[model samples]
Target chain A: MTDNKYAFFIGCLIPYRELAYEISARRIAKKLGIKLITMPDANCCGLPIDPVNHEMSIALAARNLCIAEDMGLNIITLCNGCFATLTKTNKQLKKDRELRQRVNKYLADISLEFKGSIEVKHFIEILAEDVGIEKLSELVTKPFNDLKVAEHYGCHFLRPHKYLETENPENPTVLTKLIELTGATVVDYLDESECCGGTVLGIDPNIPLSLARDKLKNIKEAGAEAIITICPNCHMIYDLNQPRIEKTFSETYGLPVLHYPQLLGLAMGITPEELALDELRVKADKVLSRLVEEIKVKH
Target chain B: MSNEVKTYRKPLRIDPEFKNLVLKMPGGETLKICFQCGTCTSSCPIAQIIDTYRPNQLMRLAQFGLKDKVLSSKTIWLCAACATCVDRCPQGVEMASVLRVLKNLAVKEGCVPRVFKDFGSAILKTGFVYNIPKTRTKKREDAGLPPLSKTKIEDIKKLAEKTGFIDTIKGEESDDRQ
Candidate 1:
C-alpha cells in the first residue's frame, strides 16, 4: 500500500509564477486525506543547470532526495520538471553504486547521504494510484457533465519513458482518464501529445509561441471549451502566454486553461474563489457560468 | 558585381577521442548505439518548428567524433531536453542524455550560454532557479498558504563547491577575460 504522507517538494515555478496550481493542489490533496509535510531546506530540482553540468544537476537533485530520506517520506512535486529530475536522479542513484558514491561525495560535504530508500512521485500519480478513481468519483458533488476540454500532459511528465516508466509517452491516457473522472468530455485533438515548447522558451521565445499557437488552434478547432494542463510550464505557455500568441499570430483563441486540480476541485463542489480561478490569464467565465447555471437548474 | 563564390569550408579538425570522452560521462553510455534513423528529429517539437535544430544530426556529429564542431555549435543548446528523441530512438540511444553530455563538454570548454550562467548564480544565491521575491512570499500568507520553506544556502553552496560547479562558472568568467 502506498503511503498517504508525502514530503512536498514545491519546485521553483509553482511558488514563483503558478500559485493557482499550488493553491488548488493543496486543497485537493487535503480533501483526499493526503498529508503533506513541507520539506525543509529543499533546493532547486536541478533541471536548469542540467545543460551546464550533469554531475552538478545530479548532485543538486540528490540533495533534495536526501532531505526526503531524512523526513522518511516519499517526495511529491507539483512541477513535472521537478518530478522528472528528482525521480530520474533517485532511480539512478539507487541502481548505480558508482554514480551514487559520486553524488554522495558531494552530499557528504553537506552532512547528507543518498540511501535511496524513498520514492518520488508527481501529485497526479498519487491521485491516480493511491487515491483511486472510485474515491474521486464518489467525492464529486458537482460534475461538469457538459464541460469539454483538452489535456496537455507536457513533455517531462511522461517522456524519456525509460526513466519515467509511467505511461505510453506517444499516446498517454492517464491525464485523459483523470479528466474524464471529473465528468468532463475529453476532446481528442490532433497531435495530442505534442510538446508545449516551454523548455525552449528561455533559449528562443518564438519557438514556444509557435508551438503554443498550434496547440491552442487545435484545441479550439476540436471544440474544447478549455485546455487542461498538469505542468506549470505548459500552463504558462498556454494560459499565461495565450494573449501574446494571439497577438503575434493575429488570431483569436481565448480558450480558458485550467490546472487539472482546479477542474477536479470544481467538480468536488469547491468554489471558483477557493480554486483561485480569477488568477488565470484567460477568463474561465464560460466554464464557471455553466457550472453556476447547472446548479441553478438543479435547485 | 564581383562574382565571389563562397566556398563551404569543412571543419578544420575532428577529435577522434571525443566519442570515448562522451562515453565516460554519466548519460553517454549509449553514444555508440545510434544508427541515425532520424526518429528523434522527426519527433522533436522544437525541431518541427525550428528547422536548424535537429537531434539526429547532433547525434551523428558526436558519433563521428567531431568534438569541436559539435561542442561549439549553437544547435546543441537548442534541445529542450524533452526526451521525445530519447523515447522514440529505436536504437535505445537516449538522445536527450547524449545531448546533455555534449552540452556539459561545451560548458567545460567555456562555451556556456549567458542564461545558464545566470541560472547557476541564481541557485547559488537563492537555492531556487528564479528568486522568489519577498513581496510574493509575504502574499502567500494572505492567500492562506504557509510560509515558503527557507533553503539552507550554506549547504547548497557546500554541495555546489564539492561538485566543481563553482569552478565551472569561475572558468567561464576567466574565459570572458581572455
Candidate 2:
C-alpha cells in the first residue's frame, strides 16, 4: 500500500516483443528505490479482443484488478494499452453498479470479485506524480543536455480524456516534461499527438506503416536526435518497424527510438549494457557516442 | 434475342430496430446525437491515411439503420481505437466505443478477423494474447529478472465461459445461413 511499491502488470507485448522496455524499466526502478512486485497471474488487459466482446474485455481487466486488490497494492503498467484498459475498467466498475454486477458475475466463476479498491497507472505517471521532477533531477548524474529527442505519447495514454483524465489529450505535456527531466531538449514536431497506429497493425499492416512513416518523417524533419517512447506497442511500430517503413516509403530515417526509461536510465548513470540499449533495433550509437565524447571532454 | 436486359442487386433493407439495439449497447448511448459534422473523420489518424474508412460515414450508416452495411463493412475493423475522435467530437459521441459496438456486432454475424481469432485462441490457451516463447521466459532469468508468474488457466477458462467469450470465439452463436 506504500506509494513507492506497486504490482507490476507486465502486459503481453513487452514479454513477446519489447523486452528492452521491461529491462530498462526494471533497472531504473531499482535505482529510484521503487519496489515493483510482479503480477505473474495477470492476463492480457483485454484490449486485443475488445472488438469481439466488450463485456469480456471488461471482465478480463476486472480480474487483474482483483489480483491487485488481493495483494493490497496499486497497479503500475508498462504498456499504455494496459493502463487504459485497467484504469478505464476500474473507474467504470466503481461508478456503474449495474456494470459492476455484470462483470462481477463473470469474476464470480473464477472466485474473484472487483472490489474497486486499487488504482492503475502507467510508469510515466509514477515518475511524474510520486517521484516528482525535482527529486528525479537530483538523481541525474549525467544529464543529456546536448541531446534533443522527440516524444511519442501513444494514444491510449491520454485519449478518451473522460476515462484517463491525466492530461490534455490534444496537447499533452507529461511525456515531454518527463523527457526534459533527462536534461534532453524536447523538440517540437508536427502531429506530435497522433496515434502510432499500433492497434490496427494486426488488422492491416499497411495503414499503421503509413501512419508511423508520417511520424518518423515529421520527427526527422524537426531535427530530433532520436524518438523516445513509453508504450511497447508504439515502440514496436516506430523502432522494430522503422526499417520496414523506410523500405516501404523509399526514405531513410535512421532515427533511434529509445524507451523513456532507457533515456532516463542513461541520465541516472546506468550503463548501456545494464539498460539493454544494444537490444534496440535502430542503433543508438550516434546518441551514445555523443554522450561518451561529452564525458571525455569534461574529464 | 439480345434485347433482354439483366440487372442483379438486392434491395437495401433498413431495420428500424437496429438503432435501438445499438443504443442499448454500452458505448452506443450517444448514437442519436451525431449531427454528421465530419469532425471524427478529420480527427482520425487512420482516416487521414485511408480514404475508404470514414467515421462520420459509419455514424450516418448506423443512424440510418443500415445494419447490414454498418456491420459487414471492412472499414469497421480499421479503427485503431486511439480515441482521438472521442476526445475531439463536439457531439460527445465516443466514436471509438461506437465503433467497438459495431465490431462486436460484426463478429456476432461471423465476421471475426483472422488475427483476432488467433489472439482469442492464444488467450484461451495461455493467459497472454501472444504466447511468450519459452526461450524468452528463460532469457528473463539470465537478464536478472524474476520468472513470470504462472496464470491459472482453469480460472481464466471459467471466466471466459461465463462471459460467453468461448461461444463468440468458437462462432457457435453465428448463423451459418448468413
Candidate 2: regions farther than 4 A off:
A292-299, B1-9, B172-178
Error of 2 at A38 (Å): 0.9
Compute the lDDT of residue A168 as modeled in candidate 2: 89
Model 1 misplaced regions, further than 4 Å: A292-299, B1-11, B171-178
Candidate 2 TM-score versus the reference: 0.95
lDDT of each: 0.85, 0.87
lDDT of candidate 2 over B89-170, digit per residue (tens): 9989988998899888888888877777778889888888898889998878789888888888998888778877887788
Error of 2 at B82 (Å): 0.3
Q: Which 10-residue window in model 1 chain A sums to the lowest lDDT?
A: A290-299
| Residue pairs with backbone atoms closer than 3 Å in model 1 (clashes) | none
